[model samples]
Target: MARNRILPIFVPHWGCPHQCVFCDQRTISGCHRPVTATDVTRLLTEALPLAGQGAEVAFYGGSFTAIPAEQQQELLDAVGPFLRTKAVGSVRVSTRPDTITPETLERLWRGGVRTVELGCQSMDDAVLKASGRGHGREVVAPAVALLRQYGFSVVLQMMTGLPAQTDESALKTAWALAALQPDGVRLYPTVVVRGTVLAERYADGSYRPQTLEEATALGAEILECFLRRAIPVLRIGLQPSEELAKSVVAGPYHPALGELVKSRVYRNRAQALLETVTPGSDTVLAVAPNRVSLMTGQKRCNINWLRQRYGLHSLRIVQEPMEDWEIRLQSSESLDKINR
Candidate 1:
């Protein structure tokens, strides 16, 4: 796996016609000023020296292809010098599913863009409509196919806890997206920002954002689905920013949201393994040293849950050199009956 260190340039809502109910692009991207070719050049000038060898120059925070052709070319052209000198590995752009066309893809490929991330926020049309995303469920597949045809690595971004969205809907979206065979995926649980329609809905009781617990539980399940299909989840939650934290009015906003989600995954795996253990018996869970915190969970949530659920008199999680997801039970008593 190639490690990515992105030099991100935010073109804040540059070509988006309608703002999604949960989005506040300016707040999310922390860039309120308009971006121009000159701006792109200056951004690269500062970022290139610090970027990793295969670092990507990412144009994010809006629909890139939906922007005017001239503007798009100007931004793409600005990165040409860096690409030519190998200062940057490749260019990446995020756009809406409906914005892509064969012509645009060819243009993107010609400009040295290697990755295209589509904002396929939902697979359910009702969820899309309620979230104010203009594109429907039908557009994502064809867009992904087109990107793949052009040899561009496809990454799909999906949202959870959106207006009128349920866990089943989110799961369906995950399976549908996985079936597309995208190179990567980004999972975002909706947060009601101060100025978006979602905030108003939350204020008026029309929408109820997921609590941290709810978000982590659902996010963990979604993460497991992608992992099972061998699709890398590039991002587990929105990037934490001062702007986002300040602007968020409600929802599952946590600085450690990604870690929380991972801990939940470990918790689930532990539960499955513990189901075979004798109840009311003490047990010790040995996992990799680096994964001790994950196995224990934040505030020992996993440990506490396992004890209560399995009726274990005492549950001990320790660190030992072990393979990833490899849980070893060490016990002298009848608790040793469980096997991985």
Candidate 2:
């Protein structure tokens, strides 16, 4: 199914029973007000026209199914008129993995929810426990199976740098998530927002968040795992907001983190291709117009790295209309192309 522009509705921290160590939903989401059905109606009424008729309204920042039955229906019922008139094509919601049930899926299917996002933070039970995620790793596959059985698109979320998580452990988590065959994946490295339990841990030297460099490096590998499986990675890192910026005390927080991760992935591919090159060879790399920056990297870091690592006498970048992540390497002697 084709994806339209998403119209997001943030209901921060609503009906969340467990306060995960790394979460401060209101601060992270930049939404402080209590949301009602009226708010959902009024906001979408004005935004849907600009978003296009095929847009899906996403309920984010909380467990939509775990809330009281009446409250959940109130929100879904508010979308009734829009669904009828085709102002919105469908509904999507994010919730904790353990909260999903066949009954809940049935209700959502009846209410026009076509997609469900589960916050499956880690696949290691120890990591989950350390981070205060109450559910075990076992719940994830069952939840995914149930969602697919109900004919809903499943999106699995994973995190890195949680307490007791290593780079090896993070990659293991990625591998576990990939085996489930999700419709898409989202990667978020842990962040320490102020006023959360994580903040208190950071103050006393009990926890360490991944550095920007660390997160980017690990993210490149994690992204590769999904890409190899032909799974689309819908997003990487947190969405930036002035409120989120002000609230974060620490962690691998960059506004353009997804770009950094993608760049590293391209750089890795180029590095592998360059390993067979003769020393002092002049070369030119061609990529899609929109991917030039990602291929070149910030401050032309990828270019500089290749020159140093491969002993290239001259390196140049030229843009061309090409497939995404396609990089063609032409040296003075040989024309070598790598495609993915």
Candidate 3:
């Protein structure tokens, strides 16, 4: 199968200035220790044989640009040989919105970094402060502009249901991020982890994470906004890992959260399409094979939804022969007529 090979090197909280109220990087990242240059080199050596071309070395789980210059260079230098040998295609890293600077961008460029992802959690200043993000939305705008000026692909990461965040604020954040013209975005709804202040608040009834259904609906809205702007949403939820699962105190956490959101979007689209058909009319719906699961929804939710909304008890869903995102619908009359 064709894939964009990525070797994720987790740098958990290496240069984070403060522990955000909702952050326990070690738990969320599933890596408890900072990765050293030696560690990176060792990992690369072991991974290179298995990694073909088109592999990217990704530095994740911390504000990479905020890390000390010497340490940053050490890690970059360790990956340099692999890049030169064509074992790795490019470098990508994630950092806090406030961490980008001229010098930081220059260093990253020199190190052959091609993509920079910013953790711009929320655009509302109150929400940012409440979440202990240490920087406001104002900080992300210029950082995004500067990263673009430096010729790097920029990706903005946003969160919903953060402390002091509302549905309006979340939508506003998405609009504001769209204004920046980022090449990509990642939408992560807040998840309360053990040992975090958010978890304490959850215990005390002072905070609540968005419900799975609520989050999926919100994420669908956000996805539509970005899709309209032609911005790729690289991710939609926190990736599930054993360590991350262990750290969760409570919240809308799902191993297949991204798939769930996508399925919700598909169901919405399917419903819209079904609306064009006459009520109580039987129809057969065909979609791509890969999308069959999504169109069907989890445990036939989509099928049931279509049945209820369109009042069609004899709806049939089939996999299309050779198409993606192409759906064909036929009534019994058409099927009979075609066969005749």
Candidate 4:
């Protein structure tokens, strides 16, 4: 397992010119107020001793580069001592794609910001406009290129089920992001939070959040595409927080959103195996014990889905000395019974 550590510091909606339709950063980030340099210093002083060596300090919940230069430097300076001592490896920040520029990249590079995550919600211009994202898809590619040119690791964040977004469009967006070759990706399925335009739209029946099942399936597909390209998926869903949970008015905002996506992937894998097995053949599926929960979904949803979809009634899953994500299947009948 990777040994890198991360300390997240929230800057709720900093440098935000206007509220996006689905934004409620205060609620989502669980930090309603701006953080000062002193706050950053105190947080690091308290967290550093507890963190592993080579930990990275992350600034999230706002457009870091777009924030005032003085304030940005103040926040960066607070962590400068630690970085110089090698107590912290580097700094990371999330910002809107449009907020990035050559100058911003240079400033961040000079301040030890080694990673930049762009909130490229969707790559479809229409979806971007409908979701009230000020920038279009065209803005993200160049931003990513610029960040990479500055020798900074680039992470792309995408959302599903946004206003005017369809599964096809979302897939297209994922493909575009893949083409950008970002070092990491984050998938955040849209959820309606209180005090956002989305909440009102939901109340008025103009917008509906993606159902849990739909989001899980779509997220699985998105994850698979990135995995195929060898891109690290930094996050699969929003980190659930008390503030965010209570504020959520609708949508698939499961606390274990990552687990849900894993379950869907397992289900897809199981189905693929079943398709190759002849009808009435008995099959025993083997997976790591720890993955049983994810393979079965929250409540055997995957198992039930398999039964209904493939007439796979005589299936058995056993724990094996295998990796978490891999599965093996053995058939009771002749090997020829394998349809494939």
Candidate 5:
């Protein structure tokens, strides 16, 4: 299947009632203004020609279905022509789990929405309450089932490093979400934004956000859980934006957060292979050329790690054509044995 090219229209927290502790939607979305139907029409008009066929028009950064009904209809009405003409293949909206209902799904279906992404941030009720989500964990599964029942493709979004979240809790949330068997998932590691409750908490030492290392480590663990179940992880971190960069007060925010997590995956995989071999000074790892950096890690951290752990005088990563996630260990004896 072709990867989706999304034409995003940011609503920027227009309909959200709860002020989640970590949210500064304007900063996160980089949109401080409200969106109108006219704006939607203009965006689609400009984007459709460039979107190519089967591009999705996504209403992101807000509770789309929770907005005023008239406004929702007006926005949907704006995209009606594109859908009718097949200029756009489908429509998608992101909304809270509690906001989904039979009536809303029917309305969305009539408006040509084929995908509904729920911001089911955590499966722990305590985490939900601590974050000011205003919804219980109980609402998530039924919402997923209901959306599936209504023929909409489901994407579940979960977060790591929330106020009460631990590595164990985050993993549990992933397992729970996987059991729902959604078509896709998004993993957003929490970042503290300025002018939010999180910022105040960070300043007062009430909430401690995960460091980049911590986030990447936990993210890799969560990511592996999803991959093992064959669920596609559509996104690994928040989309980096200038506004978000300026608004961040503290926490694990990295432009290349996804790459870091994948790099950790490579490190772990290589470690497993190393465990099966005897320690040697001249050890080398042969990985796919494209993933050399991921295999070696940022600043050659993985290379340094393997060398120290194995007591090697030299540990080198070389380019070799290999299958996905493949890494081969090479040494005098090991290489010869494998070649034989």
Candidate 6:
């Protein structure tokens, strides 16, 4: 398989109509100056030569389509040469759902954008309102439908730990997002960045941030929503950056949060498989070699927990080629079972 890479151009808050309570665009993008079409061209020129053919140019950290049509085209047009030469795949941009329209989609399509990612933070109106997203759930379905109508690949982004967000509301958003059946989703457990309203709320105790444990537990369940529907989740938690680290005031922020959440999912599955095993029995789990660390967890945490939870005399993981979700029991005793 060709290794796919992302050549990102940070537009920052170029076209954002609102200062979302949780975002610090300058800090997150590390772009102190406004991004221009010239900047896009210069950045791409400097970067694309080393990028693989599978490299995808993505506009991150702002509403790309929400920007003026001429400006949006200018950025997209900058990618024209790379597309013509097959240096990279078509571009992808993240935008607010309400910004999506026939006019914008058509312009994007004409400019060679193949994927449209919507920041559909929540599907509940109250949660949306409390989060100050400036748009409601009503626009999401129509936006997704229009994207699909244009034959563009759709990716939706949702967040957890918003103001007034509840477990049920988050899950409902996930389930509702799954119904739209986008090509992929990005699940973010909110982090309170400094200099934002969320930060103020955190300081005042008006908003409580999720501990790493709490966030991971909830993140695992939310991830399962997409897993069950076979909708690919592109990310979990924020990608660690120096700026982000410096900006975080509080909340479930971790560098390897995705791995942590995946490990938690593994724990859940391991527990289920362990349930069928006899108490105090020696057992072995066979997983793909690449997944050893994840299944074993950081510092063998999963192994220790499983041993104690299942009352097993011994438990070990053996290398084997299998699906990521597959774990086969290789026990000398009668605990032979396989988790599908």
Best by lDDT: 2
247-321, model 6: which lDDT tens digit per residue?
899999999999999988888888878889999888888788888888899999999999998999989887787
Residue 246, candidate 2: Cα error in Å is 0.9
Residue 237 lDDT (model 3): 89
Worst 10 contiguous positions by lDDT, candidate 4: 331-340
Candidate 1 vs candidate 3, lDDT winner: 1
lDDT by residue (tens digit), candidate 5, 134-175: 999999999999999999999999999999888898999999
All candidates in order of lDDT, best leading: 2, 5, 1, 6, 3, 4
Clash statistics: count for each candidate: 0, 0, 0, 0, 0, 0
**What is the per-residue lDDT of model 2 for residues 220-309, given as tens digits with 9 covering 90 to 100?**
999999999988899999999998899899999999999999999999999877888888988888889999999999999999998999
After aligning candidate 3 to the native by TM-score, how far in Å is the CA of 290 from where it should be? 2.6
The positional error of residue 128 in candidate 4, measured at the CA in angstroms, is 0.7
lDDT (CA) for every model shown?
Answer: 0.89, 0.90, 0.87, 0.86, 0.90, 0.87
Worst 10 residues of 3 by lDDT: 318-327
Better of 2 and 4 by lDDT: 2
How well is each residue in 124-235 modelled by candidate 1, as lDDT tens digits? 9999999889889999998998888889999999999999999999999999999999999999999888988888889999899999899999999999999899898888
Give RMSD (Å) of candidate 6 vs. truth: 2.9
**lDDT by residue (tens digit), candidate 4, 1-340:** 2327989999999987767899988888889789999999899889988996679999999889889988988999988998999999999999988888787777788889998888999989999889888877788878888887889888899999999999999999999999899888999999999999999999999998999989999999998898789888888888988888888899999999988897888888888778887665566777899987777777778777776676765666667688757887776553336534
- TM-score quality measure for candidate 3: 0.94
Residue 118, candidate 4: how far off, in angstroms? 0.4
Off by over 4 Å in 4: 1-3, 288-290, 319-324, 333-340
For residue 125, give model 6's deviation from the true position in Å: 1.1
Show pairs that collide, candidate 5.
none
